[model samples]
Target: MQSCSSALCVLILLITTVTTSSGSASLSVTVKLNDSATLPCSERCSGLVTWTVSHKPTDVLAECDQTSCRSVKEGYQMIHDQYLKGNLSLTITDADFTKRDWYTCTCNNKDICDVALQLEPLRSSVQMKPGETLVLDLDVSDPVEVIYNSRANGSSGHICIVDRGSLECTVEYAQRASLTSALELKGVTPSDSGVYTIQVTRTEEVIHVYTVTIQDDLPHPDRDQETVVPVWGIILLILLVVLMGGCFCNVVVLQRRRNIMQRWRKTDGQRKKEKKKEKWLSLT
Candidate 1:
């Protein structure tokens, strides 16, 4: 009876170990947008291998066996040549935010592994002046939560939460923000400049991240002085042209008068000479 009890305890321990190992087998991987993600499954099982999204387990993504491998969903594939060697890993081409989720791989109707695919959030940088408005554009299809972290003020918190059909903003600044297409923050000051993170709660992943820098409204040089100088220069140029034209007209008039005076004097002299010749002929 002592030996039998000991055997039963060992059997129970073995079953517990197997259950623990199966439950604890999981992987987390991060991939960038439009890049490829490889879900590793190193099990060398000849049974039917299937991959499915954990959220929707009924939807089969892909399935493979010893004979051939095929994709049940677009953009998902398994390397057929590697299947014989027991590498049942799946390669998803052009990964996007829609593909970010928990993936489960099964062999012969048994869960072999779980892969959590986390996509790196899209990043954008913006610079704006004080009192200007900033906009954040997100490309997620599902609902999301927006978080704001200000480096200048050392403040960090949630700005809003968007549901499938409703949009609600919690912060005062975001309350005035637009919800038509993007998040808009108005009257931004230098203290408002910092990183803004947008997370999708459905996938529990950040989908968009933005780094913003706000600058002081620097006092620009008075353009009135610069503008006045050009106006005065143009006015002075017009006055100088008028003065030169007047002087040229006066000189031309004087030259014409002098010529008229010379012609009158020559005509008088000619008349006097003709009269003197007439008197000399009469006397002869």
Candidate 2:
């Protein structure tokens, strides 16, 4: 009998551990937007479990209903409860910027347990060189998508679609300008120089934005060269040199013809022979 009781106690302990590990009474909360959060409620105990929010050991904000609870704490108001089959999520309506604080999620049927709620920041910063490519390094999260907006100077920017998993943005602009990834400019001129802002969004909430500037000056050129000219330009230059040489050769040929004609008119073959005989007699 003693052995049987000991075995039964061990079995009960194992069962409790398995229940806790296998999503029996687990809770996860994600705070985003003004007053929106998702709370994973207990799946084992099927009954009305109350959810509560506490800022610290002392500041308690709300209590849950059969589904979930929404209430006003300080200035922020909880909007609705998405009490699905197992989820006890709360959407806080009219989220206040000043109410950025820690909130604890507690669930109670008979025994009360709490889980920590955390908020993910939506603001992002990026550095880009003028005329250089823009590569975005995104924060790690699932099903998170980012939207890009590009602008130059003080003008309006453009929006673009980005892969949720791809964390890079590359665009070429002719002139220096601040462009938004959300906005793409073909010829970024010097006047386009300024801040380029890229706003990243996941679902409907704006998650992050990256800002970069394009300059009018070519960034890093070869020491002895400006921007790289196309091969066709070099070929054209060679053709122009060849044409100029041909024109010079034609002018030289015309000048030689004129000299020969003048020499022939100045003296005939008979005059040339007479002059030669006079020179020979003087020598004798």
Candidate 3:
């Protein structure tokens, strides 16, 4: 009878342990570089709340009891006002690649939740001329593999896998595709214009999903026509100003000549009147 009781107790203990270990809920959060990210905890817990790095359980990230909050990590802190309202969410400022990891949140010294921090995907587009090279700018700081996919032509494959500063590529893409600070594809054609999806992987797990649209290059504006039009306009304006000035000078000169002729005629008439007066006075 005692053996049967012991066996039943052991079974119950095993069940409880499994339940506690797997029952903890997990939350995923995506944050941009240099931005702030929040890891949510329970809002109803009143006692002590502790956050730790999941892989390194001994590393405490932050802690908040009923009365106060403190941070053990450099960039992590608990919102004070939220803590007063029973929200024990942790905020990490200036998030970067080094901050991406699994974190555990425990309330009352019991593991209650887990958080997965991921980097936000960057979305952009690239324009390239036919038979020209295409560059996909991936401003990544950590090790990652880039999977390139085309939606229109169904040319979906990985461009390169970069791990710890080492790069490897498949045989088909080895000749045309290369990895510098970014992914570059040589001799792209019009058929390559489509929606390209970039999947950044770390340890075979996708950490970021970026969308890039490939399109034909925009036609360059006719710069010569633009320059010529403005130059002609300025030349016409200057010519119009000179013509107006010439017309004004001619009108002034004609007016002055007419005034001088009228003055000469008046003087001649006065001389004739004087001669007639002198002849009449001598006869009298």
Candidate 4:
């Protein structure tokens, strides 16, 4: 009979522990980068109400009493009027990647609200010509991996990893890639066209995905300049042809003048010789 009574008491204690230990999931918030976020807790607080990191219970983030409210850290606050009523929402100004975590609210040391805060996943597209540099923002200080998914062959692989401010890429990208808060690929080619994903290395949670399209190779600027004929060069060639034509015309005119002079001299000599012969015949 005593054993049965003890068992009943134990079961009752377990039921009570389960019910009181869990705070009601009052809110789930997802905000964009640098956006404001409100973690809500709808519970009346007659005494001191405190908000803290769920994992770090002793570190209070915000607290409110009947008279006023205070935020223990920057970028976080609890309103006075809301606490007087039934709302204990903590607002984070300029929410970012570093602020994503689970938070808990307590009123008089009893759990009242549990909130899960997260940032919206980033997605964007980019178009790049071959031989141009492709830059992608890492957007996070924590360690992460950049993955490539080829659109041509439907293959996928990791391009690089950023950890502890160091970046390491695969053998294919080692020579042409660099990372300093952003990933840069120099002299990109059509073969580099694909999707890039930035994910948390530890959790494999995707933070951002980029669709990159590398267009066909462009003509080299130096080569194009070499092939193009300059306007000044064409003008000089035209002038040379004109000068040669003028020289030919002058030579023809000089030859005609010389021929006329020679013909006149020969005719005068013939007339003179005839006169002399006539005189000699008259004398005879």
Candidate 5:
């Protein structure tokens, strides 16, 4: 009876481990956007080996046979040489947010390994002046929560939610917050400077992190003087153009009077000659 009990306990433990391994991912691989990632699964298989995602088990991502290896989907592949050496790793040429999920590898239709492909948070840095708008990319289609940490107060809280391509914000940001592909705040002040984290609402996995710095709207000592110089320069330019135009008009008027006086003098000289001829003819 003791032997039976010990055997039973061992069997139960083995069954538990097998179940957990099949249901959960044994490895977690995180990579940045557009970076290549290799999900390692070293197991020799004489027959065909296949890789599939948990979301769609029927769809194959990569497959390999003893003769050769091929990728069923674009951007995913299994190296032929590596597979021959018992390395059944799935290589993603470009890791993206859309490809993040739990992936499974099978040899001859038997599950051999499970891996979680997670995407690293997209980091962003922003610098803006007071009264300017702030925008942070959500970077995921699924529902997510945006948490804001204030730089001044060193406090943090949920600021917004993204769902079904829409957004909802807290009471403090309700009037100013909007969303499209990203979360936008209409008028941000220095107090609003801080980090904004966008994470999955259900899983709480971070998708995006933004560090925002809002510069203070301090008054410049020469602010008025700087503006006044441009205004004065513009006024002086206008006055100079007007003075040049007046001088041109005065020269035109004087030239026109001089032409009229010359014509009158020529006419008077011709009339005096005609009178002298008439007096000489009358004397004759």
Candidate 6:
């Protein structure tokens, strides 16, 4: 009978412990963004915890802690837990609207806790031609990420390219920082022409768009050949006179030679003398 009584007490204690631990979710955190955001959990029960982010309760934007965070998973990013600083807060290096969503924090053998967030709007500036260099012109309070070449999906905006794996765009942009974000491209081309938007996220979000157009370099016409000379100009008149004088001199020289040749061919001395006199007369 004493043994049965001890067994009943042990069963009751186990039942109470199970009931106390069930549905014990933490009620904390209204919004999170930019830097690391903490979602408080029962530290004692926080073993093998997982943090996941979803937009409109459908699209998972990012996941952190001991699980799969595939970039292939639509709008998903696996954040580094060390970056979070153990605040249970999601550390968004470059916080973006596309990343805004409901993040659920689950503790091993414990209830899940969640927080709602709205990432501010953001954009990129400097629309440029394909293969043309583009200098990033922007100012913002919050950190921003300039992504290219990778399959990076942001809630606010994205840079679209013709080819997926072209490293040209990668080398041109994608420098992230806390205070400033800038990028420069080398030799933009026609395919690079597009709507570039500048995205800034702080307490308030702002975006700016710029239209870019690249004109083809035109060949210059030959200036020396294009210049025209007037027909009645002094220079033209002088050229004509000189040409005529040359022709007249050629005619006179030809006639004198013919007469001299005829005189030499004459067999009689008297006839040759007569021919030479004719030649002199012709010249006179």
Ranked by TM-score, the better of candidates 1 and 2 is 1
Q: What is the C-alpha RMSD of each candidate to the true structure, in Å?
A: 8.3, 18.4, 6.8, 10.4, 8.1, 20.0
RMSD of 6: 20.0
Quote the positional error of residue 229 for candidate 4 in Å: 23
What does candidate 3's lDDT look like per residue over 1-284, in tens digits? 99999999999999999987767878899888789999887656778788888988778888887678898888899876787787778889888867878999887767888899887765665565676777766555566666766657677777677665676778866788777777777887666665544444644545455544444655534754665667788999999999999999999999999999999999999999999999999999
Candidate 5 ranges with C-alpha deviation above 4 Å: 1-11, 17-25, 217-284
- Across 232-261, the per-residue lDDT of candidate 5 in tens digits comes to 889999999999999999999999999999
Query: Residue-wise lDDT of candidate 6 within 107-137, one digit each (tens)?
Result: 5523356665453333434433345556654
**Candidate 6: what lDDT?**
0.48
lDDT of 4 by residue, 119-178 (tens): 887999988778799888888777999999998899999989999878899999999999
In candidate 4, the residue pairs with backbone N, CA or C atoms under 3 Å apart (3 or more residues apart, or in different chains) clash, namely none
C-alpha TM-score for every candidate = 0.68, 0.30, 0.64, 0.66, 0.71, 0.25
lDDT of 3: 0.76
What is the descending TM-score order? 5, 1, 4, 3, 2, 6
Comparison by lDDT, 1 against 4, better one: 4
**Which candidate has the top score in TM-score?**
5
After superposing candidate 1 on the true structure, give the runs of residues whose Cα lies further than 4 Å from its correct spot: 1-15, 22-24, 202-204, 217-284
Let me know the TM-score candidate 5 reaches against the reference structure. 0.71
Over 19-90, each residue of candidate 2 has an lDDT whose tens digit, in order, gives: 776443444455664655444443322344444444353444544455544453543233233443445433
* Candidate 1 lDDT, 1-284, residue by residue in tens: 99999999999999999888877269888988899999888887788998899878779888889899999999999977888898989889878877878899888878888999878779999887787778887677688888889897788988888777467887576456767677777888888889999888665677889999888754434654555667788999999999999999999999999999999999999999999999999999
Error of 2 at 210 (Å): 4.4
Off by over 4 Å in 3: 1-18, 21-23, 31-35, 43-48, 94-97, 107-109, 141-143, 202-217, 221-284
